[model samples]
Target: MSAQFSLDNAQKDGNEPIWTVTQLNSRVGRLLEASFSRIWLRGEVSNFTQAASGHWYFSIKDERAAVRAVMFRGRAQAVGFVPRSGERFEFRVTVSLYEPRGDYQVQVDSMRRAGLGDLHEAFLRLKQKLEAEGLFDPERKRTPVQMPQRIGVVTSLAAAALRDVLTALQRRAPHVPVVVYPAPVQGADAPAALVEALQTAGQRAEVDTLLLVRGGGSLEDLWAFNDEALARAIAASPIPVICGVGHETDFTIADFVADLRAPTPTAAAELACRPRADCLQAVDAAFNALTLRQMRLLERASLRLDRARAGLVSPRQRLAQQAERLAALRQRLDQAAARSLERGVGRHATLAARLERCRPQVAQHQRRLTELGLSLQRTLEITLQQRRQKLAALTQMLEALGPNSVLERGYSLTRNAEGKIIKNGLDLKVGETLQIEFGRGSAQTQVLATHGLL
Candidate 1:
């Protein structure tokens, strides 16, 4: 007799020695397929090979666990991506049992640079979303000032990062004021806190610009900077925002969208300060340049004054020329006075004789009187005729041409369908339609006859 047997999912789980080879293989294969399909494993590559059929076979193992993975030719070709040996990555895998071989393995679907690795997966997802929206475009970023009068900082006041910024600003340029707004640098509430502090600094009239900063840590540690709201706020800030979120290699959305980005809080502080040394040097150079320029200007002005004095003309000579012109003008006047005396006397005699011969005043007066009489007579006749017989004649002509007058004269005025009076009888044929109007009534009629003028 067979002893009672039970099989678990493990190697000894089944009591199926009586089963056929093909049937056992099919059952085992299906079991392996369903088991492997849902696994996600992180591993280092080992014994990786690509067959001539374009299928990839590899073993994934670390210190603790080892698994066989097969990436089929179809899946392999679609990946367009190949991972080399010794590279550590997480792959989405599917397990399937091959019926013929009765073997089990995983199939890789797709992968990226381990996007979900210790980094904030959600943060990376948001980053890619905003990046595609072009918020991270370099063109949108404004250049930070080489020297700022007042540096505005939005960060936790209690954090060491704030003290580091203050120290660096003091070291570089102690004269410039530092405006600090307390903000939450990390956690669920950090994003809102950072945005408010940024807005506060921007709202202040005294603040020259902004520094959105936090100390370095894990990706999740500095996630406040990656907040979409904070990124958009920094981008829209009236003051330029210089982001100093974390270490050099660490990237955040704020770093990309800010007006400027620094690798650390201290670097951002150094960037914002207008150093005493640079200022002193610039002042000295300016003074020297100004002194040289002033000397040249003074010399040029002195030379101009000297040349003007040497070339100056005397007022007495100008007055003498005017006196000579007056003397010549007086002599010409005397000569003209003598000629006028002789010419005036002769002109007086000639005028006296001409006035007697021509009597122009009498002739002009008579011609005016004659013109007045003829104009009055013509106007009077025209006005009388227009008020009497001519007005009656125009009235009679209007009455005779009236449509009712012609219709009442025993002649019917025929019009076309458009109500336009027919002027020529030939305008309508016998079969064409016509509208005939008598004195009191109108009727539609067909053109029955045609006639021509003799």
Candidate 2:
């Protein structure tokens, strides 16, 4: 006989179950994935491990329960920071069952550090929203009353922060009056109560300044002060607000929107009220400063007056000195003028004497000139007679030495046909032409024969 067995999500093949453990786990994974598509879970990390494959395996747990989780390498790379043991974190994940061990686990998609969780994220979002709207602008923050006559406080009456602010104001400024507007300082309703208290104090307008005070706590505990509506109300308040929420290290939206932010509740009160003794001391210092400045100015003026007095001179004395100098100059001028006139007179007399001595003797010069002319005439006549006698003697001598004169004395002159004188008979050639001249006439002849003069 054949028996049929039943199994979950198993297909029957001819009365035999065909589903493997792996197939079962895969179907369960698909169902879980479809049931919870993406889920956010917040818990602390434990038993964390990073495999050589770069995949992360860890367990996330709250105080009571824990779940196994795995982040693949590709998704883990985008997580921005590494997951560590014992760190509180939040993640969005999908559920799946590992087929090998039938273990249920989650596949993490993304994660973040959960130091303050959603409250911190909400706080940042609201802060950024208000900042973009210019609510946190430094220029819009009003200056608080340095010395307020009446101080308004917004806080829980049961809170220790209220007592602290009152004690500080009493110690610093006992004369200043205190008005309290009580409100819850935590939980969901706290933000609206705080905003209403701010409105009430602003409407009254009796308080010179308003103080928003609260004690220090974690980000979640102080989140009420980070409310968006409360921040706007504080910014719109007619009186300037001093915010003293949380500790020195803590900050909230109210602190940023308030005109002044103190480190503590007592500090906020002290800031609004100045001590009487300190005020008196400041007034005294100002008065002393003014008096000192006035004295310095007066001393400078007195020194100027003294300097002017020392530089003073009498007008009459100056005029008398100028007159004496003028008289001396006039005496020198008179001496120079007299000396110039005497020199002029001497020069005129000298020029006149020289003119008289320079007169010309015209008659004597003419007689002497006439005597020189007669002597020159006599000497010229005598020289001319002597020259004539000498010239006649030279003419006679010249005539006596003439060749015609020699020819006239019974001598003859002979010449060749070329007119050359024939000095010797040898100079004539036979049958050559010659000419002979007596003192009175001349004849041509032929050298028919030669004769010796010897």
Candidate 3:
């Protein structure tokens, strides 16, 4: 009976296939991964460990439950911050089972501090949308007034930001007027309240510059400034806006849309109004510069006047000077005439001595004159003969080139009625009168017909 029972049990067990530990765990992991895609989980970090391989092993727990999580080296390196125990974080993970131990765990893909992931995502989305629309263009931003006559601040009157701005303004410029446009700086209704306050200030147009400021706070605390409507209101304001919405590291849509962004509320106030002492100093400098310039101009004019005065002369003194100049000119002219007379006398004596030294013998000069006269007559006779020969050749050549020479060659010259010599038959008209000249004489004739050479 025992053998029969054993056989029966073995046969029953043989109907089902057996799975090993590794195979079971692997199948379970695959099922878990397929069942749940990547998901976000928020919990406090515990037992956070960074392994020698740079992988992260940690447990994420809430008050009631906990789950094991592992981030590989590649994923952990991109998380930017090291996970510390007890710090809450939102993790994007994929559910899986550790096949080696068959332990349930999640593979972390990415993580961020709690409450920041969604808000940051929304922030980036809106920023991208507005940027695409050109709302954050640098070209559209106005230049903030260097010195506003009446400054307007928009913030909750009870808030510390308002107090900070007021203190800074009073310290920097007590004489300048300050107007407060109160609005809530935080909470659900804060965005609308801020927009309304901005519109009110803009409609009034009383202030040359407007300050939209708030104190430093966390991103969640300062989320009101990131509203789309508030950003648009700031951009549309008639007066230039100086936005100091958060600490230097904090930024919002309002900061990008405003005319100027200040790191703090006090900085916004300081930017809006120059210090009273600085203004006075500037004015004093300009006045001193003007005074110096005027003094220089006056000195230049006075110098010119002194020069003119020095150049002026009394009429009696002028006449004495003119008389002296005329007397000097008369003495110079007499000296020049005396020099000229002496030079002329010297020249005449030199010529007379040269004439005496070069005295000619009359007989010899007469003989030479006669010989020259004879030579001149002979040269004249030869020149006349050569001139006659050249004239004859030229006359003969002229005669050969003359119109009579062509007429003697059996060609007659014809002149039209207008006295123009007709060189072409085309110039002749049948009814036109023509003068035909032979070598001897010219006769008047009328053309009966014309034949074209062509």
Candidate 4:
């Protein structure tokens, strides 16, 4: 018999072990716990909850099955991470039986979102924590490189990001030197690799600015840059970093944490490196401006020198010359006064003779006006008499045509009930009402007959 336990009552007394389910589980759990103390699991997260005790209760599941998991507040707080529902997640967990319930389960240690769960979650957490610490505030963000001395790139040795950056540098900034710190730009090892490379670049005193760059990739591929550790590294770096990761739309933790975010790797390269062509053009313009300014300044200096020379005569000598000029002006003034007096006397005599010749014409105009006034008086009297006769004729014509004039002739005006005037008997209906206006009174009557004949 191969190591069989004896069933005979006395033979199995001391070493005989009968296990309760709990006991069996505890033993098996201990073994599993030991074997899987640290393990990694990947699956979509579900049934997630945080307890009052600050612990997480959840399940990690695939289409076929699921495993119950819990992260105690101690471990959870240590990492300070949680996953949202329906998101793919991965983490290091321990396989064990909960000693109290004797239930088998996994105890989660560290966690992250679907493929990008870890990096993205870390990025968010750091962003929030640092923001609370005020690291990412506008005040904290470093201004971009308008001019950079030496450009240092942190990217993989074999990467399209490097090639593109080099190509752009060659085209835009041929003269500037580039130093690259090779890194593992993809896969599980990338996050740690990136952090180390950043540290290496940070220690160097020569690197003026840092460019943390990488080629485009899916969320999983770019997850390395989203690490909180890397973000903190970027924030703490004395050298400002310009991040160019993936396409314009792709954003990572490093993007927010870095000093600047360039949409493309080539763009970041151009930003860090200096352009020889632009430098040359700037130099030429500055030289031309300086040459022109120097020429103008020299011309101004020569003009000032000439004016200085002209004003250089002794002050006492200049005063004596001014006195002589004033004496000559006084002599010229007295001569001008004598000539003005002679001209004034001749003008007065000529004006007197012209006045005597004009007096006779004035008397002739007065006589002609008196004769025209007398003829106007006769015309006014005849016009008034004619107007009076016309007024008397118009008054007689008005008395003949007026309605009141006809009433005075003993004719009455008759009207129908509707206030319409009755001009003919044909217009009246028998038994219809009528109103009549007489010379002294008015009367109302009914129509006795309808007759057209007068």
Q: Rate the local accuracy (lDDT) of all candidates.
A: 0.80, 0.88, 0.88, 0.81
Please give the distance, in angstroms, between residue 52's alpha carbon in candidate 2 and its true position after superposition. Answer: 43
Cα lDDT, model 4, residue 435: 93
Q: List ranges where model 1 is wrong by over 4 Å.
A: 1-119, 311-454
Candidate 1 Cα deviation (angstroms), residue 448: 73
lDDT minimum window of 10 residues, candidate 3: 1-10
What number of clashing residue pairs does each candidate have, in the order they appear? 6, 0, 0, 4
Off by over 4 Å in 4: 1-123, 273-276, 305-454
List all candidate RMSDs to the true structure: 15.7, 25.2, 21.4, 13.0
Q: What are the runs in model 3 whose C-alpha is more than 4 Å off?
A: 1-115, 300-454
lDDT of 3 by residue, 1-454 (tens): 1111122223354475555676668777878998876999898787889999999999988778999999999999888878666567988999999888889999999998884434566788889998898889999988877778899999998889998998999999998899999999988899999999999998999999999999987666789999999988988899999999889999998898889999999999999988999999999999999999999999999999999999999999999999999999999999999999999999999999999999979999999999999999999999999999999999999999997788899888788877888988887788899988888877999889989875
Clashing pairs for predicted structure model 4, backbone only: 88-114, 112-117, 112-118, 113-117
lDDT tens per residue, model 4, 138-236: 678786565566778899989989999888887887766778888898877888888888899888856788889998976667878877788888888
A best-first ranking of the candidates according to their TM-score comes to: 1, 3, 4, 2
Please say which candidate is ahead in lDDT: 1 or 3.
Answer: 3
After superposition, the stretches of candidate 2 with alpha carbons farther than 4 Å from their true spots are: 1-115, 282-454
**TM-score on alpha carbons, each prediction:** 0.48, 0.43, 0.46, 0.44
Candidate 2 similarity to native, TM-score: 0.43
lDDT of 2 by residue, 1-454 (tens): 2334467756656566777877768777777887777799898787889999989999988778899999999999998877665567988999888878989899999998886434566778988999999998999998887778799999999999999999988888888899999999998899999999999998999899998999987665788998889999998999999999988999999999999999999899889978868877898999999999999999999999999999887999879988999999999999999999999999999999999999878999899999999999999999999999999999999999988899889999888989999888887789999888999988998888998976
Between the candidate structures 2 and 3, which one is better when assessed by TM-score? Answer: 3
